[model samples]
Target: MRLDKFLKVSRIIKRRALAKEVADQGRILINDRVAKSSTDVRVNDKIEIKFGNKTLIVRVERLMDTTKRDDAELMYSIIEEKYERDFKNE
Candidate 1:
């Protein structure tokens, strides 16, 4: 799936446009490298999102076109330490 779509469908960024904008601004990374909105996301890939004062790191567990709110949570696993580290450094 596209990184922007995946983020929205997985309920990570809440909106596709926001995902695209953030990605275009180089605020999103895949496998630790800057990623664009069109970046392909696959299972097991690591994603990091930087937003002003916060950062989120998640391991892609699944790539779905659509999912229920509850099921969406299963799409990725939060890496709290990594997230916290990035946030702290921000």
Candidate 2:
């Protein structure tokens, strides 16, 4: 699945267009490398998203063309969530 579609289907970003915009702005990383909206997403791939001061890291657990809201969270396993400002205090 495409990165944008995966993000939308998985409910990570809530919308495909926003996901594409985010990816185009270089706010997304796959396996530690920058990724575009059309990037292929496969199982076990690590996805890191930068949201302002917050960073979300998740591993793709599965992929489906469409899923219900209740099942969306099953697609990815959140590995870490960190806030840049929080870490700055350390």
Candidate 3:
């Protein structure tokens, strides 16, 4: 699945366009490397997203063309979440 599409389908970003914009701006990483909107996403891939003052890390657990709201959270597993305070310490 495409990174942007996966993010939207999984409800991680809510919209595909916004996800594409974020990826284009280099705000997302896959397996510790910068990822583009068209980047391929696969199971077990690590995805890190920088959202303003917060950072989120998740591992792709599954991929589906479409999923219900209740099933979206199952697509990825949260690995770590860092806030502004965490960044200040690093």
**Model 2 alpha-carbon drift over 4 Å, by segment:** 86-90
Best by lDDT: 3
For 1-90, candidate 3 gives per-residue lDDT tens digits of 999999999999999999999999999999999999999999999999999989999999999999999999999999999987655568
Instruction: Compute each candidate's TM-score over C-alphas.
Output: 0.88, 0.93, 0.93
Candidate 1 regions with alpha-carbon error over 4 angstroms: 81-90
The lowest-lDDT stretch of 10 consecutive residues in candidate 1 is: 80-89
lDDT of 2 by residue, 28-49 (tens): 9999999999999999999999
lDDT of 1: 0.90
Return the TM-score for candidate 1, rounded to 2 decimals: 0.88
Number of colliding residue pairs in model 1: 0
**Alpha-carbon error at 78 in model 2, in Å?**
0.5
lDDT of each: 0.90, 0.97, 0.98
Cα RMSD, each candidate: 3.5, 2.2, 2.7
Candidate 1 C-alpha lDDT tens digits along 1-90: 999999999999899999999999998889989999999999999998887757888999998889999999999999853323455547
Q: Which of the predicted structures, 1 or 3, would earn the higher TM-score when compared with the native?
A: 3
